[model samples]
Target: MSEWTVHGSRTIYTSPWVELDLVDVEPPGHPRYEHHLVKWAPVAATVLLNDRDEVLLMWRHRFATQTWNWEIPSGIVEAGEDLTVAAAREVLEETGYQIDPRRLVPLAYNQPIGGMSNAEHHVFLGRDAVHVTEPVDAHEADRIEWIPLDRIHEMIDRREIVAGVAVTGLLQLLARRCAY
Candidate 1:
């Protein structure tokens, strides 16, 4: 077993989305060290598909990266809530599409290892959805549009949507399709 010691920790920043912390610790057989850690809230996302095989996507401006990117409807999972429930809620809040929990197909989970913290993302595929209203999360996304499934590869190759979660979810969906 590895030895661990936490000397101290401090919050570097805090937002509704995430909190960053700097922690001083000692690792096994190593000198004392400090690492800037991100304490992120759990997030849930959905790959919603319609009868026409179109994927629901949102165009948003990521202020941290200063880039406009295409992403699926997603949000921070509330504490004590089931991941699937969170996914359904996020889709409805972000894209105005309410989907049954049973319709959600588990796709993948992502923990961006390159990042300082472990932010687990639960991704699901929402099959056969019907639009009910317009997006309401003004701060989260600018526009919600349905992109044809067949064109996703071209968009990815062109670097139109570069979010890791979106890419992973799309690839998982593709793999599932190819397996049939």
Candidate 2:
């Protein structure tokens, strides 16, 4: 059992994308405290690798953070949608690449911000992706490229790849490749 207990929770706001709540929690040695909590649909991220040993990346500006960085294609898994299907659909919509759902290998999952949010990100490694069309979402990326896998660590060291999901996904793929 956890050392803390949630006594009650009240919804502060609700939207199609996210929900916020105020939770009353009691810890072992402290009085009850109210914590702000956020709930969101789980996300699926794909590390798409082409035959040239390059990984697909999107370069875009995140308004919230006011920083431009490289990120993997990812999106929320809609209700009633299969995880793999959702990941492939996100890749197609964001990068104009059609990837076989079967080629999506589960890599790892993470909760990037457990203190304030209850959202899980499922990461996958996809291979054999083919360009089908331009990105359907105009804001998906300012530019897309297939960057050499060998330079991922260098990019990370240069702080060009900053998104948590993308960094974790790529590192997992790199680790797995080295293990083989």
Candidate 3:
């Protein structure tokens, strides 16, 4: 199949986290028209492990989804910020678990929404973490805890870890047993 041809794009709105664009495009064997395109900031997240082989997780309430779930530390990568550094920053800010940026190794990369959005995710694996301070972003999660890696599948099966990025990171860790 041929690639979609983009003639032009007009920004409808934009913010630090998201942008709305109307792109003039022609898909193969289709009519050319303006399509709504969503542009999102790339996200970075980490599935961190402790010496006991437990995974660090947070019990969070997502207001938009109106659901409570367990998730790994994650946040939008800032402009010009290092992806690994950003993942480490999120770990500390959201969970109070300080991790060496260098220790974070890439585990998975995915563009969650490709047809209508430029949303992307980078998931990392961290073999070590240290708690140096209380969480700086107190509003991020209500509870932070270490979960046994063996229980991840149960939690996921029960929909406890429903966030796509979080699920992706955890599943990759389980599938590959990635040691870094």
lDDT of each: 0.83, 0.92, 0.92
For model 2, state the Cα shift of residue 149 in Å: 0.6
Residues 1-180, model 2: lDDT tens digits: 457889999999999999999999998878999999999999999999877889999999999999899999999999999999999999999999999888688987999999989989999889889899999996879999999999999999998999999999999899898542
Number of clashing pairs, model 3?
A: 0
Give the per-residue lDDT of model 3 (tens digit) for 1-180: 999999999999998789999999999999999999999889999999877879999999999999999999999999999999999999999988889999788999998889899899999998768898999999999999999999999999999999999999999988887554
Please identify model 2 stretches exceeding 4 Å from their true place: none
Q: What's the ranking of the predictions by TM-score, best on top?
A: 3, 2, 1
TM-score of each: 0.86, 0.96, 0.96
Model 1 misplaced stretches (Cα beyond 4 Å): 1-8, 178-180
Clashes of 1: 0
- As for candidate 2, its clashing pairs are none
Give the 10-residue window scoring lowest on summed lDDT in candidate 2: 171-180
